[model samples]
Target: CFYLLFNSVLFSVLSDVELRSYRWLQTMIFTVEEINRNPVLLPNLTLGYLATDTCLSEGSTLSAALSIVTGQDKAVTEQCTKAPNVSLFPFFFCAPHLQVSYFASCACLSDRTRYPTFLRTVPSDAFQAQAMARLLRQMGWSWVGVIYGDDAYGKSGVQLLIQELEGSGVCVDYTEVIPKSHALEKIKRIVERIQSSKAQVVVTFAISPDIEVLLKEVVRQNATDRQWIATEAWSTSTHYSAWSGISLVGTLGFALRRVDIQGLGSYLTQLSPEEHTNEQLVQNVWEEVFGCKFGKEMYSGPHCTGLEKVEVQGEAYFDVMYNVYKAVYAIANAIQDIFFFLPTYIKYGQSKKLISGVKFTTPVGELVHFDNNGDPSASYDIINWHMGAEGKVEFVKVGQFDAARGPQQDFQLDLINMENRLYIIQVPVSVCSESCPPGTRKAVQKGKPVCCYDCIPCATGEISNANSRECTKCLERFWSNTDRTECIPMLVEFLSFQDIMGIILSVLSIAGATLTGTVLTAFFYHRDTPLVRGNNSELSFLLLLSLKLCFLCALAFIGRPAPWSCMLRHSLFGISFVVCLACVLSKTVVVLVAFRETLPGSNIMRYFGPAQQRAGIFVCTLVQVLICVLWLVLAPPLPTESAGGELGARVVLLCAVGSVIGFSLVLGYIGLLAAICFLLAFFARKLPDNFNEAKFITFSMLIFCAVWIAFVPAYVSSPGKYTVAVEVFAILASSYGLLLCIFAPKCYIILLKPEKNTKKSMMAK
Candidate 1:
């Protein structure tokens, strides 16, 4: 059996050795020899290989593939009964022959209808594109520029990348294609686009040679501040590593996972020109590594000593060499299966089928097999380029990607101390716009991608998180905090005794009650005096007592409203005012009846005597008591929270009148008694008597009626705690008016003018 190896040998006309490609060629030869020496694998079968140089040209690659199939160019190809071709080139014209490649990673090659016999040891570019899209999203790089080569590999890879970025909030601002001819002016124009782009991150989907030309211009123009994302094609290329000083210091890319093959390193270091004199590629590599000439006649340089050795400098030389080794072993395993288990006389088409089903574990313990698409299991190592000793580039493994894991668990990054190696102190920011913080939401621009947007603050009663698309309104009883990031409970307000307004109203209420007590004491002390007897001291004492009760009832309105307080405050105010008004009405009747009885044998005093006056007061007060009972039983007031009107940020704790009609009737009854008392006192104000008590009763009733009439509008218009304050003020004002108007003149006569309190002053008018 024979293995045909074809690879790009020449990169330019100057014939400089591409060390990385040369290492891949040597890896294939070493694997073929290792398999032949194994005892149990293929006992007596020996494998031979034919190496061909394509000179990195498409025409040359096609010609070399044809020569291997026809067995016309090499003696080894003619002697072999069966040969499997292994190609390192990406693009090829598919034929019926079995072609297994170590480097062809174009996504189009995975189509079984287009290339029926094509298979590869490396993963397709489809998976690499997905990985690239995920990396950009993970890093929050929403805006970026893409540059691809003009070949099938570059075009298909970038097309798949853009498709994977759909709906991910990652946009490609511009895409430039590298020319096939490597023209200087065309490459310069592409560089100009890179420099002018607003995106700080640039991604490339081209092979090493195409990228090398473009980067040369990039370094010449000194455009080195961008963060570069590389594909597997040229991530570890030594060609760029030599020239990548600070220009590509913190470059990030994906590469095939590296595995250490035992004895592979020692075999690579043992290469010399004397041992491989028959191979021209080996002699050329020897001259390049040792800086000497194999033949002094060909070039005027020092001749190689034939003992010069090659030291593997970096893993860049062996990164893709493992792929070449796996391809050779896979073909040998397929042949072993064919001879031992299958029929000896197999067709050429059957050989391709046999290789497709081959599965084996490598020496490094990695399972090697191809799937239905003729591609291996997809996996990659995230590589970061760092400046190493003497300014050389080092490939640091910072993360991993596996296709077999879950979507959320597949891509992982471990970038410990990675920021120290970057050109800047922090990870580069590559977004078109900054992210929206808390309390703000993103407003998308009219004609741009979702990533390009403006940030707007949340409304007054709303809140939002970082990068949120919309603001959420707070609940009814809640309000937004100062930063608007969260919702908090609103401030609850009520007429509490701790407040300044509540304290002032409470003190005034106490003072009025105390003054009423003082007046009641003075009347009791002088009960036998003529002035007190003439005014009917029993009615005077009862009126003063009722006024004191009215003053104390206002205290219930100046505290936190509860179910009991809400019901009691209105009931007490209604009943106390009714009793006080009944006393005033009885006194006014007594004044008019006394004047009529003195004129000429009148019977009015006989009807309105002490017993009759007490009955009249009791009947009037009983009517108010029945109204309060019905009001509390049917629909009484209760404490409730109100958040309407200007109380947007707070909740007002106040009493809600359950039935408006019930409350109106209570106030209406008090007004009816006051109207009767006022009209009777007005008629008796001109009575022929000194110390006319009717005059004081008329003024007190007028003041009481006026204060409550003004309170109606103020109570209805007030909000929150002020509504309770207005009601308390009305109660205090009316109580003080009755106390001062009716008794202030009587107290002055009894204390200051003892002579005027005698019987002579009582009968002066």
Candidate 2:
């Protein structure tokens, strides 16, 4: 009995994969040789073997098939018997599917009539197509390129892959054909297309030779950084491994599940000339793996004595080689069962039933069985091409793809550190363009995808926060940060006592109050002196007290505004100045009337005496108090916030005066009283210099009027806290004018010239 094996491709320069298949062929031979030696199984007969390369073409495959059928290229010492033809190669899966195009009568492998003898240990290519689709989806890759050779195997597999890919959420950006012949110019154009296109990731479905040609062009074009999703067709091929400069660094692909046969290493360890000298296949494998020549012949290189070890060489490529080992055992078990259980002769179609669903346990403790479609369930490994020294490659299994396990659980990739020029531990980028960050909205280009866009900043009163796709308008109560990335509570802005302006003003106001206190003390100490009693002494005392209140009113303007402070700010200002102005009016009148009475026999002092002067001051102050009460009852000052002022981003907290009429009345009343006093004092400016206070009072009233007149326009135009600041400044300026102008002369004389303080010295003028 004999078993014949056929492989699709073999090249000396690109023969690592071809050599691997040859190792698998050796495994099949070793299995038969072991069985022939065993006493319990196939003891009465020995199994012979013949394996050949088909070169991945119809001509080569047909030629190899014809050679096997004609019984040529066989050793003369082998047994002469007809053997059942069986093929378990993975590459042959698409061949029978594409044969319907060549021959119209031929159906696919759906029934036994089209091809009765087709059987395989490896699953069909259909499972691989689904696996590719599911793998791309698991990685969130939707846009990609499809690259395949223009052959029957390529056409059939690509068609199935496209069907599965469409069922998933993926779309192909471009599909290209690799020429059957070695056309360098055509391949160059394809590589240039790949470099210029927008797609950064590509999916390849081609054989080793086609993949090698395309990858070499990719190296020439220096498109090494692009992601490549390799199919099972070329993922495990070692042809491109030694091309160290040709970078395939981050290539993700599907590979066959690996297994180990028990005691296979020990069985291969005892290869020597003492057992078999005529085994030319064993000698060739030993030379190819160990890099040595065999026998005692004189040669240019070192020779193997057949004493060389071959223990682990077969296990190194177990992913592919294990299939052949399983296939041999599958056939052996089927034949043994059929020969033992039934009397039927073992034919090709009849023997396939016994092996279809046979279960066995591998040395790795994994259970293997086939499904109803005459194919095993999908169990592919997700592998990455890791680069090693001296142009070698190591296939690392980073994930797995199993159809029976469902999509979500099946394709789980190990998170790896995919490095770039600027960042480490970054995910591999696959896109037409990068995404827009916060504070910007995406503006799509005319003909590009939505992913490709320009970023635009948000408009006023709006913000885009933390990668937001659109801008949102901010509420009136909230404001945006300077970066426009987030919203924050607005600041309460006012001239509070904590501010620098407030602090400075507060200190000045307290000092002014203290100074007023000092002056009041001085006056009290000299209450009965002639200078203190020069005017109606009661009126003089009242004016000083009113000025003290004016200085204290400035404190109300310095603090954070509340209802009480707001009302008191203007009310205290109005009433204090009115009291002071009443005192001035009374004194100016008294100066005129008293001088006239001295000139003649006038009796006006009796009619308008000290009591009448006090009445005049009382009536004037009462009028202002009435106005303030009415203003408060009608439209009182209330605390509020101001937006859209000179201060951006700060909302001013202010005491908003409710009525224009009330504010105007408050200032107008003070102005009228000052105007009357100014007129009265100006006419009396020529009174006796020694006893006259009219000139000083005249100048003081003039300054007061000028200050109030200017304050009206300034107060209306000033913003929030500044409006109050203007009013406070005007009050201090006018009060200081009255304080210094009307009293400095009296203090100077009383302190410096005490003799002039007598009543006789005052009357001479």
Cα lDDT computed for each candidate against the true fold: 0.81, 0.68
Prediction RMSDs, each to the true structure: 6.2, 10.7
Give candidate 1's root-mean-square deviation (CA, Å): 6.2
What is the per-residue lDDT of model 2 for residues 1-765, given as tens digits with 9 covering 90 to 100?
644443433333243334555555556666667667767764575666555554443544565555655766543212112211212232331111111110010113424454443445565567777777877766666567788877544666678888887646466767888886648899998888787767777888766667778998898777776678786655665645556344776677877777766666565555565466776655655666677876657788887776665555422546665666655555555445655743453543455455354556533566666554445566787777765444456666777777778865766666452222112112355545455577777676787545456778876556886435688877886776666677777777788788787777777777767767777777788899877887667888889899899989998887788899999998998999999999999999999887767646567688778889899899999999998898988998888887634324667888888787887798889999999999999999998758588998998998899898899899889876787778777888898889888887877777787888888888876
Estimate TM-scores for all models. Answer: 0.78, 0.55
Error of 1 at 121 (Å): 3.1
Which ranges of candidate 1 are over 4 A from the true structure? 2-17, 42-99, 106-118, 124-144, 149-193, 196-198, 269-309, 313-317, 337-356, 405-409, 420-426, 434-494, 523-543, 578-636, 639-723, 741-765
- The residue-by-residue lDDT of candidate 1 on 280-326, one tens digit each, is 76677777777798657877778888786568865553557788888
Model 1 scores worst on lDDT over the 10 consecutive residues at 75-84
The candidate that achieves the highest lDDT relative to the unseen native structure: 1
In candidate 2, clashing pairs total: 4
State the lDDT at 28 in candidate 1: 80
